[model samples]
Target: MASALRRARAGEGPVLAWPLACGSTVAERTRAVDFAQGVLRVEVPDVGWRKELQSFAPQYLAVINRYVGESVKRIEFILAGQQLADRADKNGRSTRV
Candidate 1:
């Protein structure tokens, strides 16, 4: 879970957009996304989103840091569907999205 202090410091859009665009609910988005040591890892929905967001990363970073009043050095975007499939296969489960 995301620390409430961090959430409060980071404004709504800056905090919510990352996970929401990645297919997580606003509340769950904050909780599920890995945030540690000034880095946030989000599971993006697709390659298109990743490509687009990659271009806008600097802008996004400014907004996030400005709102949160702290520097987050990196934003890592993972392909969630593919990642889940890989995990499922390794665990002997169906690769169902």
Candidate 2:
């Protein structure tokens, strides 16, 4: 299901690409944005990144609005499980048991 969604999104230009290009360090540090949902969901790897994003929310929203054509009213910062698992793999830890 997720793969299909990703494939479909890949066809759309700028919706997802813009965020990757212009997102702040905080945005990049977090997981990818879901443009379909209109939510910039960031994984708070640590409190520092969380704080940084919170501080820059307004500016970030402005950038998002410009590309998406609607003001992204909310930015969701959470610890996403997939991002954690990917990090574990990068660190040489197997996610599979």
Candidate 3:
């Protein structure tokens, strides 16, 4: 299966590793929402936070994977509201943004 395809929504290991992996500074600004397959979905305050952290995905993955043992292959940094929008979209609800 493609790494991007998700058959599951959450994984305990990654959620737990997320905080420690990213550290206190980032952990305060971001949330470890869930793990969809190998992708860890993280919620950030806004686009700036998303864009900035996303650039360090590799470094974040290194730390996260250390605790999760490479179970996490990708990090998806999304806006806090984006998570809700994505859910609404999946439910056939129209979202403005």
Candidate 4:
């Protein structure tokens, strides 16, 4: 099901559009989790980053929309806590900030 979903929306996902929208510098400090119902969920390192990025939502929306086919209407910035990062690190997953 997951693979099918990915296949169906392969080129139209906001997750893929994020890096291009924010650029490498910002992208390196964040992770685009998913997009659904016009909302794109992005994980930031902490509150400072979340607040900083949230302020740029409108602009991000514009760029994201262009690549996502105007499907993302809102950007939701969530915190990527140290606990989460630690877990990812323990699991050998990238806990990039």
Candidate 5:
């Protein structure tokens, strides 16, 4: 059961990371970001990082809009969850990942 759940989460992982792909340097450190039902949700690695990102929300949104080629009106940031945080740490320096 645990393994199955892990697999499911692993599959959904990429979907969550998609929006952070072209974001700012702060966004580059992001663990996950998802656009669902008109809301953009982001997960950063830590509180300090989250605060740093909040200061630059507008810039991050602009980058997201450019990468996605659409207007993203809102963004919410949080402390990264387990699976997502691990992925971020692994791929934090790779733009092509």
Candidate 6:
């Protein structure tokens, strides 16, 4: 299967195009982890950012969905480091604190 980035590219989705559309500052500390089941998983720096960012989820979702033809239904924000460990665990790699 093509990676989410590749799929986003092929579909012209927000995964790679968001930073170009949105301001660099908004995308700087944020990352697109996965887009599936109409949910866009985003990784933010911390809880404060997450809470602040959550308020913008609706707006972001609108722009993203509009850009990608309603491909995204929601934006789920997670912690950057937590997302990394989650990915590692998914790949069967042990994560050490």
Task: Write down the lDDT of every candidate, Cα atoms only.
Answer: 0.56, 0.55, 0.79, 0.77, 0.56, 0.72
TM-scores, all candidates, are 0.53, 0.51, 0.80, 0.70, 0.51, 0.71
lDDT of 4 at 35: 71
Predicted structure with the largest lDDT when compared to the true one: 3
Runs of candidate 3 with Cα error greater than 4 angstroms are: 1-10, 95-97
Residue pairs with backbone atoms closer than 3 Å in model 3 (clashes): none
Q: State the TM-score for model 6.
A: 0.71
Deviation in angstroms for 24 in model 4? 0.4
lDDT of 2 by residue, 1-97 (tens): 2233244343242245335434555445665434435556656677776777778767766655554433356666656576667668889997878
* Model 4 Cα lDDT, one tens digit per residue, 1-97: 2243334464346787788789899999999887778878888989999889988999998876655544777888888765467568889997686
Off by over 4 Å in 6: 1-12, 88-97
lDDT of 3 at 10: 45
| Residue-level lDDT tens digits of model 1 in 1-96 | 234334654434334445433333432422325555777666666678667767866766665665454456777666766657756888999866
Ranking by TM-score: 3, 6, 4, 1, 2, 5
Model 5 stretches with alpha carbons more than 4 Å out: 1-28, 82-97
Worst 10 residues of 4 by lDDT: 1-10
Instruction: Estimate candidate 3's alpha-carbon lDDT, on a 0 to 1 scale.
Output: 0.79
Any runs in candidate 4 off by more than 4 Å, and if so which? 1-12, 81-97
Superior by TM-score: candidate 2 or candidate 6 = 6
Q: What lDDT, from 0 to 1, does candidate 4 have?
A: 0.77
User: In candidate 6, what are the lDDT values of residues 21-45, reduced to their tens digit?
Assistant: 4568979988887766777788888
Q: What does the lDDT come to for candidate 2?
A: 0.55
